[model samples]
Target: MKIAIVVKEHIETKGGLERYAVTLSRGLTARGHEVHVYANRWDVDESLIFHYVPCVKWLNLLKVITFPANARKHLAKSSFDLVYSLTPLYPVDIYRVGEGIHADVLRARFPNPLKRFLKRLTPKHRSILAIEKRLFTKGNYRAIITNSKLVKERLNQVYDVPFQDIEVIYNGYDDKLFNTNTRAYRGNLRDTYGIGDKEKVLLFASNDFKRKGLVYLLEAIAFLNRRDIRVRLMVVGKGKTAQYKRIAERLGILSQVIFAGAVTDIERY
Candidate 1:
């Protein structure tokens, strides 16, 4: 089968969605299917074919707005068995909604109904929400692929999408890379970071630190101060950790938590 996979940026990126696209493309290619990745920027890999989509990048929002539009136009000129979009866009045979619905994200980020309403009016939010609504409600998309059951439920709750139309395909991890055998590297890694062998280490890896509840984790550590066991948190990701560091200091766990920003080998944790 000939497949066209559409994503906004490089599949080799550190982001979860980007990594998944790379894995999916490679998996399909290994199965003897022709896979083409369509993106604005991508790491050159001999194993897969990449089609560049030209777009304006003066502003971050402009790139987001132009990528899908230009990508769609480019894909229209090419023929393929299926147009699989990783983004929320129309005229695609299959859509993998990895980010979940914009409405659901907005709802979670802004608990207040008025804030959510106002957020929807913003250009970035409005563009994403419009595309999301169109994809679920009006677009002739053959099937919707969600990364989790929670996302599938959100689709039903937000857009009234039938259960039959949604496919809950969870993300897969590399067992070869991530396994119990990594325990051998644990001591060395801890030593490198000055983490004592006696201390219990908690690993939290997410690009978006705030959304991943880093503050809550720090607070939880503070509450456990009465316990005899020593606990330390190793944060590995890209985010503004200054505020979270202040929170840790206030909680009196500043020395216990270590922010190791964005390590490439995730298995090391």
Candidate 2:
């Protein structure tokens, strides 16, 4: 069957969504389906997008309607048997990807006017949220998949949707990359910072450290140190690095802590 997959960006998402899209796209290709992906050019792996469009950057916004417009045009011409949108973007046969965390945040934080403005400006995200909402009231999809049961459960709670319509697909790990072969992995990581083998290593990897709870992790480390657990925390990746570092210093764990900024091959760290 011919298919078209659409998404907002191609870059690896810190969350599970990136893995969701990549794995599904690859699987479909391997099965010999004609899959044409419409996505942002920033995403790696040249094979995924059969058609490239500017996505998520400032200049692309100048032609705000282009991505969806062209996506629709391509879908119309292709007469795809299935249009599985990785995001709740545009009108599609299916929206397999669920809503982002910002949904809960917006409901709590933004007033009506600001939220309405955001709705107008970036209808793609809001459209996904609306689709998710409709999933409760309508069961029209061939299938709707969620990356986590956590997300599926959220849908059930927020939308009063039954679990039957929402299928829970947990995130998968690339076992080859994460397997325990490399002491050189954590070893060089520890050695580079003079961390003793005896010292405990705590890894924190997040582009957005705050949401991933890095500060709280540091505090937990401090509490542990006060009680004499003797941990050597190793923070990896960017985003609020300075802030987390300051917290480490203030907590007097600076000497015990190492900030290894944004290692691309996280396995090495």
Candidate 3:
């Protein structure tokens, strides 16, 4: 079977969605399917065929729009038994919306009515919403896959996509990289970071630190500092850690907060 996987970023990119695409493509290839990946910018993998979609780098919105547009055009020129899109692309056999609905995020995160209204009015936000609506409504995708029940509910609540049409498919990770076998590295990792054996370690890992509530985590660590129990937080993943570092400093838990940055090997800690 010939299959095409569509995503904005390269499968080799370090993120939940990228990992999913890589894993899915590898799995499909192992099962005797020829997999082709379509992306705007990608880290190359020899096992799968890659089709690049040209887009302007400066205009973020244009970049988002161009990838799908080019990918669709490419798809029209080519033929595949199955077209699976991780993004909200039109006319795909399957749409896997691992990234939750942007509408829901806007509404939940920004409680201020004025802010929400203004944010919705933005070009990027409007474009995302429009594409999502089309993907759910007129695209006629055979199936809509979500990473969690919350995502499924969000789809139903936001776009009125039928609950029956949304299938909850959880993300997969490297089990070997996140297993009990990594226990040996725990002490070494802690010691290397100057963490005492008695100190409790809290791990917060996310590429987008702000969205993942890094500030909230630091505040929690602050409150926990008041207690007799010693606690330390190891922050992993990419983002401007300087702001979070200031936050930790302000909370007087700077020593306790270790900004580990983006780590490829997660299970080691």
TM-score per prediction, in order, is 0.93, 0.75, 0.93
Candidate scoring better on TM-score of 1 and 2: 1
lDDT for each of the candidates? 0.84, 0.67, 0.83
lDDT of 1 by residue, 106-219 (tens): 876777999989988988888887777777884568899998899899889989889899999888998888899999998889889998878788999988775567888888
lDDT of 3 by residue, 116-164 (tens): 9999998988998888788889456888898899988878887888888
Question: Candidate 3 — what's its lDDT?
Answer: 0.83
Instruction: Note the residue pairs that clash in candidate 2.
Output: 10-43, 237-262
Model 3 quality (TM-score): 0.93
Of the two candidates 1 and 3, the one with more favorable lDDT, higher being better, is 1
Give the deviation of candidate 3 from the true structure as CA RMSD.
1.8
For candidate 1, report its TM-score: 0.93
